[model samples]
Target: MERIILHCDLNSFYASVELLSHPDLRQTPVAVCGDPTSRHGIILAKNEPAKRFGVQTAETIWQAKKKCPDLVLLPPHHHLYREYSRKVNDIYGQYTDLVEPFGIDESWLDVTGTLHLFGGDARALADTLRRRMRQELGLTLSVGVSFNKVFAKLGSDYKKPDATTVISPENWREIVWPLPVGDLLYVGGAARKLLGQYGVDTIGQLAACKPDMLEQLMGKMGLQLHSYANGLDADPVRSRFEKEPVKSVGNGTTFPQNLTTRDQVRQGIAMLADSVASRLRHLGLYAGGLQVTVRDPQFRDRSRQTRLSAPTHLIREVTETAMDLTEQIWKPPSPIRALTVTAIHLMEAEDTYEQVDLFGGSAATRQRSEKLEAAMDRIRGKYGSSAIAYGAAAPEKEEDPLP
Candidate 1:
C-alpha cells in the first residue's frame, strides 16, 4: 500500500510568534533579528508583510533594511519559540503516533494507518489541522500531503501561510516535473550549479538523466538527486519510538566579538565544551572522541577531531581535549567569530567501562573527579548555571585568565 505523509511548516515561525504579542504588527512589516551590537545581528525570520518588501532570513540587518526601510525589528525570545514548538508537536500527536519533527518549526507525520479516523481525506485533514492551529494558537502553517516524505515536504513548500497542497501520484508528474531541479531536497547550490551546467535545470530533465553519468558528475549525491526527481524516495518517516539514535552532542555560539587572544579562544572553547559534556552526562552517554570547529570572521571554518584515550563524560576531560584539538588548527591573534565543541563516537554509559592507564592517575583519583563533577551538577541544578565555574569558564570579568 502507498504511504501517506504530511509535512507541516510554521510560517515565518519566529516573526509570527512575536506578532502574537504585538498584534498591531500583524499587518506591518516585521522581522525577528539578533542585536547587531553583539555581532549577532542578522534576520532570523520575517512575516508576510516583510516578505512582500523582499526581506529575507539570515541576511544582515542592514541588508534587510535596505530592501524594507520600514521593517520593524524585534529581538528573539528563544524560550517562547521552544514552548510553541512543543505545543505544536503535541497537537500533531493527536492525529498520529508517527509524528516526526524535522526542526523546531517543521514536522512530518505518517497518517497512513490512521487517516480514516480523521475522515480519510489527506487534503481535508491537512486543512483542518491548519485551521485549528491558526484559530487556537494564532499561528499559521503550510501543509503538504503526498504519498511519500520527500514530496510531502515539497508540497508544504509549494504553498504559503495557512495553506495546503496535495501532490498525488496521478498529478505529481505534471505538477512537480516543471519545477527547478534545485527545488528537490538536498540539491543545494553546488549540486544545482553542476546540474545546470549539464542542462538538467528542470526536475523533468534531471529525472531523465543517465544514473551512471550523474554518478560520475556528483558521485553518490547525483544518484540520490535523480531518485528524488523520479519520485523514488523510500525512506520512512521514523516515529518517536523508532527515532534514530543520537550520534553526537554539540554546542556552538557566535561570540559578541571576534576572539583574537589565546585566553579568549580558551574561554569560548571551555564554555562550549561544558555544555556538550553536561548534555552527554544527562543523556547517559560517553564520548570516545572530541571534535572542534572554529569559524573565522570571514565565515570560513576549520575543524579537527581527536580520539580520546578513554571514553569520558567529565566536563574537565572534554574541555581539555577540545582545547587541545583547537590548538592543532588555530593559533593566537587570529580573529575567530564562532566556536563549536562536539562529543562524538558516543556509547551508552552503562555499556562501556573506563580504560585505566598504568602511568595515569589511580582509580581513587578518577572516582573523586566523577563525584566532584556530579556534586557540581547537583549544585547547578538547585541553583543556576551561573552559580558554578572552573578554569577558563570562571565568571570573573576582571581580565583574560589564560597564560
Candidate 2:
C-alpha cells in the first residue's frame, strides 16, 4: 500500500517567530544569522520579502544589509525556538505518534491508518491542521503530502503562504520532471556537475537515464536519486525521538589561507575537540573512540581514528587523541586547510558505574569526573562555554574561535 506522509515546515521560522512578538515586522524583510564582526557570522534565515532582495542564508550580515538595508537581523534564540518547536511537535503528535522532527522548523508525520479517523483526505486534514495551528499558536505552517519523506519534503517547498500540497503517482512525473534536478533532494554541486554530462539536467532527464548509469556515476546515492525522481520513496518516516543518532559529533571549517605551522594544526584540532567534547556532554555520554578528519589546502579530505580502552569525557583527552592521530594520519609541512574531530562509541553518562567492575578503574574517581563535567556544563550553559575554559582551550581563543 502507498503510505501517506505529511511534511510540515514553518515559514522563515526564527524570523516568523520573532514577528509574532513584534507584529509590526510582518511583511517586512528580515534575516537571522551570526555576528556581523565574525567571519563565521553569516545570514542564517531570510524571510520571503528579503529573498526578493537577493538576501540568502550564509551571506554576510553586511552583504545582506547591502541587499536590503532595512533588513532586520535577529540573533538566534535557540532556546525560544526549541520551546516553540516542542509546542509544534506536541501539536503534530496529537494527529500521529509517528511524527518525526526534521529540525527546529520542519517535521514529518505518518498518517497511514489514522486517516479515516479524520476523514482520510490529505487536503482537508492539511487545511484543518493549518487553521488549528493558526488559531492556537498564531503561526503559519506549510504542509506537503506524499507517499514518502523526500517527495513530501519537496511538496512542502514551492508552496504559497499557509498552503498544503499533495504529490502522488499519477501526476508525479508530469509535475516533478520539468523541475530542476537540484529540486530533488541530494543533488548538490558535484552530483549536478556529474549528471550534466549524461544530458541529465532536469528531474525528467535524470529519471530517464539508465539506473546503471546513475549507479556508475554516483554509487549508492544514485539509487536514492532515482527513487526520489520517480516519486517512489520507500524509506519510512522514522521517529525523531529515537535514541540512535545518525552521527555522534564532528566539526569542520573553511580557512582563508593554508597554515605552515604544526602548532597551528594542533590548535585547530584542540578547538575542534572542545566542540566535540561539548556535544558529548550534551548527550550525557562519553566517547570510547575518536576520529580526526583533515582537509588539506588543495581540498583533499582524509581521516584517522583511535579506539580507547575506556570512554572519557575530558576535553583534553579527546584533544590529545585527535592531535596524536592527526600526526600519524597526515604528512606535515604542506599548509593545512581544515581540521575536524568526531567522537563515537558513546554510552550513557550513567554507564560509568559498570566500568569499575570491568576495568578496575576507581568508582569514586569516575563519579567525581561525571559530577565535574555536569557542573561545567551548567556553568557554561548560563555564562557561555568560554566563561570557564579548559587549559588547552585558553591558547585557542586567542586565534579565531569560529575556525
lDDT of 1 by residue, 279-300 (tens): 8878889898899999888668
TM per candidate? 0.79, 0.73
lDDT over C-alpha atoms for residue 339 of model 2: 76
What does the lDDT read for residue 46 in candidate 1?
95
Candidate 2: list runs displaced more than 4 Å.
252-260, 274-339, 342-403
- The local distance difference test score of each candidate is 0.88, 0.78
Let me know the TM-score candidate 1 reaches against the reference structure: 0.79
